[model samples]
Target: MKCLPSSLLILAVFPLVVVAKRRRVPFMNCPSTKSSSGLGMVKQARSRIECSVICLNNPECLSASYCKSSDGYTCQLSQMFLAGGCSGLPANGDCTQTFVVYPCENGGTFFHENRTCHCVDGFIGDYCHRRYRDCQETPLGNVLYTIQPFRSDYTFQWKCGPFTSPYTRVSEYASVFNFNYTLTWEQMKQGITPHPGFYFTGPETLHQLTKQGVYDLFIRMIVLGKNSGYVIYKHFRVDSEAEGYACHWKSFTRYYEVPYNSDEYLDGLGALGDSTKSMKGARFGTFDNDVSECAGTHNFAWWYNPLGCTLVTFDPDGLNWPTNRTGTVEIEKIDHTLIGLRNVYWYVEDDLIL
Candidate 1:
């Protein structure tokens, strides 16, 4: 593991990335005295103009009605109008009134010039109804997990995806310990290994081991920038020192022989030995010796291979897993400086021991 250049002068200044302006949609007038159903009280406004502005900001508000009575001006916002049914009496006398609604689809309040929907956090689509991929399904359906918001107190806000939840206040830790971004194995052993609270094992109440006969867990981190990533050790368990774990990399070299018959002499031979040639009956283990050791060890262990474990990158679009590129993932000061990460999720895929 080589350290990044210490002289890597932190460029304090960088060009600001320009964001495109979003288009605003005009509000339509609804019939006076007629207010839609499902009118949840958002707030009180002094005038009709103030009422309309409130309705426009609320994505769920489909229409707003303003009424001028002896008491004063009153505004009412509704979510379900097309469903039909007026709540209040028709306006009359000097009580002049007006109503307005915006044309938005699938609970989307923000409209862009491109005619696309600016969905609320946790949703995306032309109508802003579809859940973001990360939130749609558990990373590994087979693995149990939990999701929580990652909070940072830096001066700048993290550029989390729209789907991510708002940051929550949390106790600050050492600068060297950050699970928000990708970390190397060495970094994990040093930083996170000491902090058990940051990660979660499956079913805290359940004492049973994973179906694979090992402890499987889930963790999240902040993705600093493009091409930058992290590696998590499998078969994680607490030890005197949080070290000695491996990634279950996929490779043919990892395949080895297992004895089909318990009575066979080859059963005593470890997978690494050449006892397979003379054995009359044997079965090849799905994974190599390293994987077996890591899985079987009572102490903390993990399966790791340079070839099979792929590095993934998280960008504004979404997760970008291993491509044709090959090399150890690199983290630069600029990587964290240029772009703030929103969040990253990892699912442990442990092989079932049959």
Candidate 2:
């Protein structure tokens, strides 16, 4: 076929972009422990002195009230104005809210302000969107998936997502899992063309798994609730030098690119929670072509898509696991003009547990 074009490939990628989109921005300034609904939640500081508990302690407390009898004060959280304060205001101090704290990849806690929380890797915005593709947050729920990663011929850093298990397959897109020690090169070669669950980094050139041998991949995503399962998106034939030149993918990165609007894959989570499964059934996406490849392989890599869906995934936490989840995929046959090979192909690999 056409050897990937030059300059055009490099331009395929640009700096990352992050924006803000929420129903009403559920922010709070009071310590009432109730979600801020933009309405009057806190009774309003009964007296100016008790306001300290609501205002002095948390600068975000724009309004407050006192339970004259309970001897306690409740603070009404104001709209989180610019991380710290509103423009020109005297600036009370740091009013950053401290709620469900999760550990970011590197060695820090996720960022939280104005209600929306995200990772700390230079990412600042709704759901941690403003950062390199490698910086998106990977919500590992309660299932506690524990598995190691293996490589084919070539591999890169950002290309690796946390795999709770390793799998192999044979198809045009490679759909089935062969695991390790059970398949041979001839078996793998004649097995499937492209294995399912294939994901890749954002690069201009195509990256082929530098090593063309048997490789297993372990991937994990944050699934909410007990039997909920998240789609595993992993890239294969990656880390190859020639593939890099072909795909022009140098800075490998992946993001949630999840679709939140679909019925198949929805973020079932109820917005905020304490544990991964407590994610409240946050959906990930639908099994549509956006999440499939053999169908068309449209690069719908971002999570929380405007049209995508999310669902409660198999709790990766120790409490619950997807006992009924199953994977569905398409298997097709194609005659790749370049290789002069008429082969049955399978793409858009996915695993779903009911």
Candidate 3:
């Protein structure tokens, strides 16, 4: 047999190694809890009532389950989450344990039994419930996708690490919230190719100015072929903040950006202002055809990069979000992180105006 190359040999063994390392929960192994019969309450979980009883008696148990239909029960321990779905149990009697509760952005803290978060006054509902939602499903790129369908939207997540943090506190600029807007290509202004002017030369000109890459490539094609587009607005709440004696403040802002453009823009195809602000003239434009016919494809982008200008990660290893996993590559070492904090993005918005 011919000798195999090192790379090929490694590839052959990697799958076996990965398969062997897969997480396995031993069928019979679990934490040892006190048992009345000395073997513990290992029995079949027959009803929600049984589960509630077991959960109530065991101080450590958050909820409980029966190990088998035959005769044993196991109680999983501590923590009060929004209680529902259990039809048989009385709602008030379910979670009586005294512990602290915190809001989503409260550093996962706990103050006292249900004392940490106040249902922002004037709110009246069980647990002061506000609707929980995922990031708005706005059309990305030049694609004309409709709003998510009824009865069955989709499940999603915003795994924002330190990088995508925002620049200002939510309380300071509430009006800026309106920045969120969306458009179908039908929402864009329609136009025919005309004799070339500087405005018409945007894409071609942008191509000449910047090197080709994923984002730049889109700017080039749209500026040249179709036009620019806008992403629906994204916002971040002030998760946590502290005003230092030295007068330092840090915050984060998040938004989704779609390829936005206009043939008859505010400045008549002139420069865009700051990323956070539009030019005095740039007006919103729309197209009659589908946005999919345009050049850019809207997508999710974590704000900033590993730098964390908005959501500054005091410690990178702590959060573990270093690489982008797609499209974006990591910037080695936090010390090698990008700076300019807010200025760079502010200008990128300025440079990309049509």
Candidate 4:
């Protein structure tokens, strides 16, 4: 397992990358009314603009009411909008106003006119944060899914097509972890992996994304050396993990598999059911630490196979497909690997909704 020193240099050379700008959504304002109830947070604000800024910054604040009196101004933040915008009436011409903030997450469309979020397929919540894992779990009328495979570059663009009647998987790559944009070999050899770029989401970020709900992972390996131009696919379920960390994975099982191309179809990850599961359970290791015992040998950090170091992981070097199912022969020297979590649903037919 040789390391590409040049690939590591990419981290230092391109320290800065452009991030996609977030769409600015204006606050919905209502005049001459105070929140009668559902206030979860209260703070002192000198002006209504400050109250609106406070609501925008808070993750749990959905709406807020600003009240001006003789003494001072008070901002009451609510987790929800009571009675559409405000619950109370204006008493004696009191200066009270409510500002509604958009609560949609994960690229859900927010309608300013109605104060409602139209979630993309697979996400269901007041804020579209929860994700459905499969067709059986998704509700009807969700948009359909069709995978557009093998993208070489990385970007923060929303991959979902236009919303339609039928429910489906909205995006081909919902969340991606790219190994190419990580720290240099020198940094990694010292057991340091800094996730600074938009294209790369490190272990810590991955832990947060998968902690909430059931998720399926799609792994694609691009081989550049020995077996050049070979692409492989692996699919698996993320059962459980340790808090605040992503290494100690458990209860992993190979379920669904996606094909790379029409001519060659493979399910190489199915071999993880045996002793390989134990290998995955090993704590993550850096090159210097070598917790998995194979990280030093492979010149990469990963939850490596404890046994003889089987090639079955999202690690750049471990992106291999077995020539035989028994795991005897495998094509190695993979240059790049794309590991993505399925955050949306595949299409669910109306008849299957029972």
Q: Rate the local accuracy (lDDT) of all candidates.
A: 0.29, 0.24, 0.21, 0.40
Residue range 1-354, candidate 2, lDDT tens digits = 111111100000012211212211122233333232232345455543333234334524433222322554444444333232223322223222212212123333333332223345333323332222111122322222211121122222332223331222111111232222122223322122222333233221112221322222222232333222232222322333222221111111222434421112221221111233322112122224122221122122212222222222211111111222334321211111010001112231111101
TM-scores of the candidates are 0.23, 0.19, 0.17, 0.38
lDDT of 1 by residue, 314-349 (tens): 222222222112343332121221111112232332
Worst 10 residues of 4 by lDDT: 4-13
* Candidate 3 all-Cα RMSD: 23.7
Instruction: Name model 2 segments beyond 4 Å from true.
Output: 1-41, 44-71, 80-82, 85-354
- Greater TM-score among 2 and 3 belongs to 2
Model 3 Cα lDDT, one tens digit per residue, 17-56: 1221122111111123311111224433444344344443
Candidate 4, residue 299: how far the Cα is off, in Å: 0.5
Give candidate 1's error at residue 116 in angstroms. 19
Which stretches of candidate 1 lie above 4 Å from their native place?
A: 1-25, 31-44, 53-63, 70-72, 76-342, 345-354
Alpha-carbon shift of residue 39 in model 2 (angstroms): 11
Residue-level lDDT of model 4, residues 155-184, one tens digit each, is: 111222223322112111111334441233
Q: Is candidate 1 or candidate 3 better by TM-score?
A: 1
Whole-model alpha-carbon lDDT for candidate 4? 0.40
Write down the RMSD of candidate 4 (Cα, Å): 17.0
Ranking of predictions according to TM-score: 4, 1, 2, 3
